[model samples]
Target: MEPEMLQRKIIHVDMDAFYASVEQMDNPLLKGKPIAVGGSEARGVVSAASYEARKFGVRSAMSGYMARKLCPELIFVRPRFDRYKEISNKIRKIFHEYTDLVEPLSLDEAYLDVTENKKGNPSATLIAQEIRKRIFEEVGLTASAGISVNKFVAKIASDYNKPNGQKTVNPDEVEAFMEGLDVKKFYGVGKVTAERMYQLGIFTGADLKSKSIEYLEQHFGNSGRSFYNLSRGISYSKVKPNRTLKSVGAERTFNVNLSSEIFMEERLENIAKELERRLQKSKIAGKTVTLKIKYSDFTLQTRSKTLPYFIADKSLIFEAAKELLYQEKMKESVRLLGISLHNLNTEMKKSVVVQLKFDF
Candidate 1:
């Protein structure tokens, strides 16, 4: 391990069941009850479930019907993204008070590097506790925190004692701690990857560490290097304060499936407008336009076109999306329509800047 890697201090902060908790906090009647925030049981997925619902095996991304089956008394509420965003902004303000090296993974989770924080706090653990304390005191919500030398270990530690808890992994204990961890618990190791690892006789971090980098690369491709380094408690990725935007997109699921091409065009227009709005707000443009369609049967199809130049205008985006929509034949009545812009100009500019530095 590099000496510089050990010198860094990182903390991962995650809100505890953010959406469901917000619902409960706003309405006292929901306290101590199992609740899910999402669409109705008929044609919706669970966006978030309270810890009480999780005990009954309900989880985010699960079908609402299945969630209800798991926990019969589960209450459902529509998502209030606007409210969530408002609260997220407040939390971000709190994070900025401690360190500008804060990288937001989502509205409810972020990674902060406090090696040289504004407060000059030497103890990352104390900083994490303080941050969590302020979040609860000011936001009326609980947060879990993980403190460690690097982001990967810190992120995993955050989940160890969740829901208003904090965990810290000292630098000396990182190796032993990682070796004892289950392969499924490793960051980036999803269910499918874990199953594959199990078939390969790699069930834990220790088992993963036993495999050669070449062997892992042969089996997992580019992700093999990440698995190799992460299992050994090595991650050099920094806490990027202004992470580059990769893509801009917007989608909407309709109450009823629309079979008519005209109605689909109207939906596409609205989705394109939303995508353009997001791109403009971010001050970014992209060359690729993708059209996503989800059928009533849950099947999804996408068509994309890469333009000659980057564009953020609504009309241009809609024109490209409209062309992609017409390029493909509809298989079923569509329940959802979406538009996305990719290959962002910001990234292109970054590449240009890097090349210029190399030339200089």
Candidate 2:
């Protein structure tokens, strides 16, 4: 990570309304209205809601009933993942034209490592604008771009302008941006963390940075390290390409809530080991495993384990997950549990598609 060699140039591109936008682009009648793509029936929640719907407080994963209540004009439509994936592939191709150092965050968003890009662009800011413009012109869809010295800032910058726009945050501007940004606007800091920060008088990055590292660590633990560095506009993570999701999963909610951590741990461990054995049996390895815990109060928290290498061994999986159970504070009782495999691969339990994109 030499400073001169790293001259860090990063861009985070996020498609506007993604699934809903693709729907609008493909269908003429759906434009300029509050639309959502999800289960059309009342039993479902919106998977991707349009900006118009967002104006009314309707959001993704929110119940259809609630969405309808928020926006009386909301129109629910069934999802077409196939179509969305097709569009995603197209956008990915566009990204490759600029640099192979592209990391797709989702079908809708990605991080581009353009420190030494093939496009020969001097500024990552211009590259982002050009990419967003090309997507609009060629794909008939709007995308927003964020430009900064690192992925963290770029990811947030892209969202500042909303749909059909782009923004840049240079190194010198980082201080002003962070100082003005709300604690809630941070990527991983959730509602609970935001409230805690507010109570601690950390309403903005300036407020956040004023707190000493020891104070932050005492209050926020491991996440505080990230907060301190981020408040200084620094990030050390790399942008790996064509990342494969390690473990596939399924989780169901119980009518009853588990009152004890031991019961909850066992329930979660079983699910993890079951999935782990299946993956090992298939000869796949994963580096990161995540635990999704939902409490009786309907509040959710997640913890993750990233090993030195991919491993699908049941014992290893269960042990790491069990350790995570005690690593976090869980005051509320749990109602649901889920496990997912991430940062997976084939070489050493590698990604199923890493080779396909790696050689590109």
Candidate 3:
């Protein structure tokens, strides 16, 4: 039999309705009310919704019309990204106090490895609790956390008791916990993937564990090996303190649909300028240029080209996007246009595996 692997202490911390919560905090008059952070126009999309709004079916990425229809009392507020970033910085400062191994996933969520933290605290559960308490006291924000042996389980457990709560999956409890989990609850398994798994008689982790590796590979391709290991509560992903940028992009949703190629080219020029500004701000360049198109019917399509060398100039980017735009004929009126540069010069390298040893 193979020897057992050492367990590492990992924690996932997630803020509760970060943008909406900040708005409420900044203006107490909006407290305990249904509010969404985004435009309230016909073509607007909700960026975030408060818990009160979520009860009325208001959610992020949902249309403003649908959100207002579901919650007649919904109040739409413009997003304040600068203020949100200021608060996010304060929260990240708190995380650094306990461990320098913090890996931020976004402005509101992060994964932390506390196997050898600064405070010398052995119990990750206590560390998580302390961190959450500090955020509430210091930042005036309620945060939830999950503590477990690995990143995958910790991320899932973080959602169990949300809105200012925490949960811990003990090392011995990982297997049973994963077995009883719904397939959709596994990270990266979307609705379409879950439905496909259900069609294959794989509804839960237990069902997934019953399938052979070959069978899973034949159906899931590269993701098959990932699912096979994750179902058994095994994952090797580590928390990198410095995660590299993968792509730089900018997109605009039009207030009016345009069918003419002239209008699209104009929009692409503006998008390419914005994309170039972002790339320059980060001193980053990429070899791949992609054009994203969303038709009036809500259908989406993307076209990409990889050049021999990286380019970050607006003129070059715009030229590349123009080539992609005329590469195929338009199917319908276009409502959205986007330009993205991928294969960045700062792509993240493969993680170095480190054997973690814990006395307890």
Candidate 4:
């Protein structure tokens, strides 16, 4: 690893069951109970499940019906995205108080580059504990943190002691910590990839490191290189505070499935209009238009068409979407439809390399 990479101090903070915890916090009656945030109807999908509910197999993206079947006593509440965003902003404000190099991955988590911070604090371990402490005291919520030499290790460590806990992987501990790590526990290696790794006798970081980069690239494409570096705790990806917008999209799930092309087109038109509004609001134009379709059985498919010119107008966007819709025959009744614009004009940005150093 490069000397600068080893010097970088990164911390990943993640809220504990953020949405469900917020619901429990606002209403004390829900505390310590098995609760899920999302609709309870048959077609409803679980957005977030409290730890209590997780014991019964309730999880985000699981169908509400299945969640109930797993835990019959589970309680369901509607999602309040506006309220979630409000709290998220408060948390980000706290992060900014420590460092301007805070990169939010979502409403619940973020990566902070604090090698040089506002607090003049050199110990990343102490910084993580203090940040988690402040989040609980000020926001009436708990957060867990992981401190390490780089973003990848920090993110994986954050999950070590979850539900309001913190872990710090000093520079000296990174190698052993990563080698013993289960392949499944490596960040971004989903079930499918893990299964593939297992098939190849790569059950742990050490197993992954045993393979040649050329061999891995042959099996996993570009991701092979990423796997090779992460296993050795050698990621150079910085904490990017101002992440670029790669795509803008809008999707809708209907209460009823539409099988007819005419009905689907009517819904697509409305979705196209919404997409146009979003693009105009962002003051961006793209040359590629993609249409997403979700079937009643919950399968997803996407179709994309790259035009000769950039477009943000509703008519042009709708026309492109319409052509993609008719370009293929429907296989099943459609439950969801979405439109997105990609390859935006505001797509290029220069990356800066900063000196990174880590210490406990």
Candidate 5:
């Protein structure tokens, strides 16, 4: 491979236990506690479990019943998919501040190409560390970052030092680093694939690299080409910029304070209905809801929440929205109300682990 072609630097940033961690950040009481967000009761499932809860082996997608059984002291908070979306948007705004070449994998994970960033900074490692520090200071959140010459190495680097940590892999160290990784940790090898590889005695990169292309293909089929290239730690995929603005919402103001419940209900209903239509036509279903409001005195406040998954139902949208409006206590008689959904990119539903390998 030409050295110039591999000179680009990529960084992967992933928030720590995104949903649960946000809840812990907003409310000090929940800090440092074993917390899970989703269903609180025995029948509920854990959407996101905090680092504390993870110590007990609790994990996202595990049933709530099993989580509590694993750790009796675990605390369950109802999942706020709406709020998580808002925070994700805030972080996205921050990302754009640095570079437009940001590809968000999910609400909490993204690939940032800073090889020729807007800042003109020479060190990708410094950019990653700065990004991590900024997230903590600005958003009251912790993020783990990985820095490498390309996306595959960067993504793996991010996981190496996780939960508010960061790692960087220099160009010369790529071979040594990937050669030492377990086969299971290879980009596309999940539980089933790893078990099959284990049965084949392919425990590490060295073992995977030992097999010939034809032999590996005979065993693993077409994926053998992927295994061959990934064992050498090579990736060529480019960062996809998240530039689409899926939905837009606007609110107006009136000089007189709106004290009539009937008028306010009618007003909220109109805005909510319009927002709902925009989302539907755009094919954007969001778990996050943001309510924009202005006080009688022209002051403003906004509240947002994220849901378990994407939802396009008008009633459900307004229901969560009305709840947020009321929760804000309507301190000043509301002159205007607006609601917007920002988690439009959640539509990228497929597992983003596209092997990150060139099937040579």
Candidate 6:
């Protein structure tokens, strides 16, 4: 390990139930109530749910019907993304006051490298507390923070105490802390990965560390090295600022499935227009166009085509999407339709060729 790695101080800050909290803050009547911000109860999915709703197994990304079944008294509210983005800007301003090395994960979460901060505070824990305090006082929202020597440990530590709390793990304690942690709690270990780990008798970081790199690679492929490094409390990934945009896409689930070819074409055109608008707003064009379809029975299918030139026009995107749609044979009624553009021209630069002439 590099000596400077031990000296780095990183902090991860995550808002507490961001959208739901914003709703509750805007309307006092929503306080202490089980509420969700999403589509109507008759259709769509939950974007965010208040803490009260979570107690009854209601969670974000869950279908509205299932959430209602879990909590009969759940109140559904439409999302206000513009308002959330406004508040997020205020929080980001607070982060800038302390450190310039801020990497925003989303509107509600970000990572900060305060190893050398503008405040010259010398203590990452104190910096995190001050940031959280300022967010509450200025933005009227609470945030949780985690502090450590690296991004991985810091991100995990931030979630240790959620909902307006902070936790810090010093460099010396990182190894011990990781060894005792549950494998399921690791950042990238999702439900399927956790189940696989359990079957391998790797229930904790200590269990994962016991296996050799080759053994792990044989079982888990490329991610085995990541698991091995994280189990030993070693990470070198830096907090990237101004991360590049990867893809622009839009998707919508219909309240009723569409089986007619003409109706599907209309829906595809709308989806393509939305994607074109987003691509234009981002000032990006892509060579690849992808069409995604979700059947009523929950089956998903995707088709993609790469064009010779980049395109961002609505008509062009719609035409490409229409071609891909007809190429596939429909097996079931589609419940959702989506269009996406990939291989974006966000950072493409013109190449320069130099010629050298030698004189004798």
Residue 14 of model 6, lDDT score: 95
Off by over 4 Å in 3: 1-6, 347-354, 357-360
TM-score of 3: 0.94
Residue 42 displacement (Å), model 5: 2.4
Segments of candidate 2 deviating more than 4 angstroms: 1-6, 242-244, 250-360
Over 4 Å off, model 5? 1-3, 243-360
Candidate 2 C-alpha lDDT tens digits along 1-360: 453343377889999999998888888899999998886535566889999889999899897879999888888888897799899999999999998888898899999887777877777778888898899888889999888777888888998898888888877787789888998988679999999999999999999889888999999999998898778777767677756554565354555687777887778767877787668666677778777888878798889989997767777777777788888678787777787777767542222211111100
Best candidate (score: lDDT): 3
Better of 2 and 6 by lDDT: 6
TM-score of each: 0.91, 0.74, 0.94, 0.93, 0.69, 0.94
| Candidate 6's TM-score | 0.94
lDDT computed for candidate 6:
0.88
Question: Which residue pairs clash in candidate 6?
Answer: none
List, in order, the clash count of every candidate structure: 0, 8, 0, 5, 10, 0
TM-score of 5: 0.69
Q: Which stretches of candidate 1 lie over 4 Å from their true place?
A: 4-6, 347-360
Candidate models: Cα lDDT each: 0.88, 0.80, 0.91, 0.90, 0.80, 0.88
Residue range 1-360, candidate 3, lDDT tens digits: 121454788899999999999999999989999999997658889999999999999999999999999999999999998899999999999999998888899999999989888898988998899999999999999999988888999999999998899999987788899999999998778999999999999998999988889999999998999999899888878888889888899999889999999989999999999998899989999999999999999999999999999999999999999999999899999989999999989956555445465542
RMSD of 3: 2.0
Q: Kindly indicate the candidate among 1 and 2 with the higher lDDT.
A: 1
Per-residue lDDT tens digits for candidate 4, residues 214-316, read 9889988999998998888888788888888889988888888999989988888898888888898889999999999999887999999999999999899
